[model samples]
Target: MGAIESAAQAAAWLLAALTRELGLFAAIGLAVGGLDDLAVDGLWIGRSLWRRATVYRRHARMTMATLPPPEEPGAIAIFIGAWSESAVIGAMLRAALAGIRHGDYRIYVGTYPNDPETERAVLGVGDARIRRVGGVLPGPTTKAECLNRIWQSMLADERASGRRFKAIVLHDAEDVIHPHELDLYDRMIERFDLVQIPVLPLLANESRWAWTISATYADEFAESHQKSLVLREAVGAAVPSAGVGCAIQRAMMARIAEQGGGLPFSADSLTEDYELGLRVRAMGGRSAFIAMPVAPGKGLVAVRAHFPETIEAAVRQKTRWIIGIALAGWDRLRWDGGVTERWMRLRDRRAPIAALVLAVAYGALLLSIVCRIAGIRPDWPDALEPILTLTGALLVWRLAMRALFVTKAYGWREGLCAIPRVFIANIIEIAAAWRAVLHYVPGTTPIWDKTRHRFPERVGE
Candidate 1:
């Protein structure tokens, strides 16, 4: 009985000490990050209200139908970088060819020489507009390298046909193209050097909707497209390309290529699409993020695709993103921009830190639960009360905002799911951050850490 009492006291003391440290750390980090998020939320809300009152009051609200069509549609080239994507490339091409309501555009599918199955699938599409550009390098090269091959092909085709493309669009083989996507690009590319539409994850079947990991992407993209990117664009910050549903003017593409010695996308960067968007802004190119609906009460004209549904797949994909944006991106694109740009960059690079805080926060919560169950009272610091209270309130606010945006994009069902999915997302983020640290610390060349992609059975519906 004495030993048991001593053990309980020791455990209680350890819990008390660890809880104070972790709880304090978590509280401070959450407060700082929560304030940052609150600022963004305020900016987004204020800007949106201002626009609705001022701009919409004066002019008719702009929807897809309201946007003026290009008087003379210029040639647009859609580039899809495929490395061992034989399974979905054919379906995606078919969907794009059937869906896109444009006349003067060509599809450039870049496939590695080693990935002949994908190249064959591209050719098998049998559409005259679909052109297969075989990469000089073999499979598993950087996506930027594959895209560069497609760029060269576009240049060669322009020279051969005596027709130049007005804009170049980037997409993945798994993307479901919108019918009026090219129309939006053709109209917007004339005014802006770069234009990005929203990307919504497609929950094609009931299974996909039920998959927690898959549903998380829907919540994430919905909120990001509706709020974060919108806020970024409103503040004139560099809008990062989502790798799909984004178009860059041919002139801007040429400028980027010239600046990078004939490669528009950087081969050195893992997240070349993201880097391309920022580089465009750095080069004084105008960019816009458009999230308009096709009609007054219709769905958004956005790129839709199936995201990784399994935890392992999701972790692998997110690990790549964390390594690229949060780790290597800092080394490549050092802090250089206006205040808004720097603020956005900080948000982008906060993933590792955020993950750490989240981990510690969860650990502390678990410890508190154990203390209660074991009847071990840990005398927490008096100072922690206010901080933890504030943190709790901010967390509720953050979850509410997440649910609000997600509900606005999706429906009430997903909105409710978004609350619990916050925990899932935090776990995945922590796992990905740890994996990213391991992968990035070795100083090895970053290859295409591509995950297996799924195409919707019936896309562009």
Candidate 2:
């Protein structure tokens, strides 16, 4: 075919994909919103309360039975990224102390040489159990690289001491972990090589910014960590790793490092957690997801990372994540070979179709808004109703499941408030994914877009 003819065909295909995606989105919005309303109403009226109550009961029983045995002792290594402020570092130190008190665990904190506050905070823990390493490490200043250096040091220490760690847990500086998180780690050590805990965002009751951060993250974990991980596990699909609240065995970590250390910490990918998860799975390891326990009132653990507190900061962080995960890691994970290599390869190839569809859907919505404002109706055919309906129903089911999980993990008030944020988050994510795609040029060094923490005013000085 002539170049002009080929171009015409490509344009036609793109348009068709966009049209189909828009119909899907509209249907999804309507169905999910409607079902959510129905669920709320039903819960208020008491018909679905039985099911909800039963679920609650089962969860309660599990929590009660899953307490860690006192005899089962394990060491935990916590990695807080470079550039943490004092308040954030302080919170981490407190949690580290708690972790030490709870187990026969030694705390190994990995940080940069220049972070004096982090170093001081490690000392502040005042426990001989805590040790700091890699004060000065080479290579990219990304989280992955920091972790790699720490892991290498840990391996050396273990070899010298002739002892192996039972678990290695990653944590952010702002994390305020529930005491029971250590217990959960102990209980689950026997069943899975790696255990990932759902991370809950701690929002200050008075801060609107906190509310936004809480809702967005809560909804995300609800869907991705809770439901999606469960679904993926059932179907043998590759699961993405959350950066923190995750624990891996020494044996598994060693195995992954032996396999080319997968991708080194670099500026190329912003999502070190996702990349690590992919590499681990690629190396024939198994991972399990445990719901963040709610008994401690705030669940097993919650992270109180300081969000942008302003719109620009939030947008920058979200944009970086979007570009990194959707653009960089998406390609890397899709292409990475492993036990589920073929399946992942196929999923990665088809995943972009969803992003392209979303982009088109947004464009159509903009056009529709414009048309409505101008008193013009762009006619869509009646024949697409069933397709639209099915698409909407599926989306509603997905979101409904997400909302249910969120409500259970947090509370109804938080879950309900998070609905709008969930939509906004998805749009941000889609935009990030597309942005990453456009910038996927060759020879791009991974950029570590560092997030600034709002240290307590006293610490800030």
Candidate 3:
């Protein structure tokens, strides 16, 4: 009788443990479901508002008509990446041509060490205004290093010539530019120390892969450029910079140079553009986002970056970004400031917690499944049914909202289809978060992950 009672007690304890695990799994699933709904809905609403508020066509015309002339001849400095045949590059060249034809801006192309193909391409244009500069410093062979070297070289040249630039613009090789992009820059230079215009993605009729890349970029840019920046400005928060389509003042560049020519940022962060913006904010400098007016023939610019033809390449590129931005740079986000700073801090803080919770929930779900397979009974109370239903509803609503926003930014078909992909991506992102945590434990130099480009042969050529 004593042995039988002991065995019964053991069974009860096992049952209790199994019950707890099942409950935890249910709760977590509900929570994640709710978050998904919230993210989608919020993003959709925010994007829609941004689109309606900024009337691009009228703004562009107004800007062109009233803006002052270029501060001086060769006052504008343009930085172009030299590699590959990207749609973004084409757009940038078009913009450079426009600047040469209309604005009195001096264009400079900052490129890798002696690429004959790039040289041939640039020379083919027969434009004397565009000058190419090689030998970017630090010799790391990364974009950040290349950019820093270019900035330093440009500054040294300016100082030697006793001519200071009024404005500086960075362009990727894949960008498409409108004729009036420079005019927009001219007007904005009058007000803001740093100004950024919309960086749209190219829309093409061929290749679903192209469409996918373009649409994804469109969604991302719409959120970051239009909604987030506007909101940050309204709340007096530091507006983070995008990688390209950025223009800065000469005085700001000089100040950054004083800080040791480190790409205008204090730290060697993966998201260098964002870090630069934060540094600018820390120094009491202001930045603004300019609305790109879309008219019949007046779209500002579009880039075709990484139209990955294969799933493997897409995954590799995304993983590199994840490791760089989410994993390596997590700790570098500055949280000690005012109210805006506090909000940013909170956002960064919660991301890791969310990832952990997801991991825990997944673990619990696996435990629950295993216990059930082993004939262990779960003793969850029936009273929790209502709570579980409410949680699940919230989750579905959140996902629906995100889907709606994606649809508005891209299209319903692609956006809705991407929901599952987004969830999978979040799981991968969580892995990145864990990797970041491991990196912070000891002596770890940030690993530079390089993405290989796929330059497919042009169709019908």
Give Cα-based local distance difference scores for all models: 0.89, 0.60, 0.58
Winner of 2 and 3 under TM-score = 2
Tens digit of per-residue lDDT, candidate 1, span 1-461 = 99998997887898877877887889989999998999999998999899998998999767888898886689999999998899999999998888888888899988887888888889899999999988667779889888998999899999998989999999999999999999999999998999999999976355643478888888889889999999888898999999999999998999999988998988867899999889999999988999889999899889999888778888999999998899998888989899999999999999999999999999988887887887766767788889888888899999999999889888988899899998888888999999998889545567898999988887653
lDDT tens digits by residue: candidate 3, 1-461: 99998997797677667657657665755566466435534654676566567765345443444546555434578776564333233335654575344456666665554455565566556676677666633223455555666677777777798977777877666544445666666666667777777665434446765455434444555445545566666567666667677777778766876775445543354556766666667778788877654354443333334334334444554554544444444556536579766665455345455667667666666766876776766666675666567776885665565565456555687567555545554565466556555544322443334343432233111
- Count of clashes, each model: 0, 5, 23
Please write out the lDDT profile of model 2 over residues 44-111, one tens digit for every residue: 33633664678676765356245647455776666666455555766557655654335556666666
Work out how many backbone clashes candidate 3 has: 23
TM-score rank order: 1, 2, 3
Question: Where does candidate 1 stray beyond 4 Å?
Answer: 1-8, 204-210
Model 1, residue 120: distance off in Å is 1.9
lDDT of 2: 0.60
TM-scores of the models, in the given order?
Answer: 0.96, 0.75, 0.72
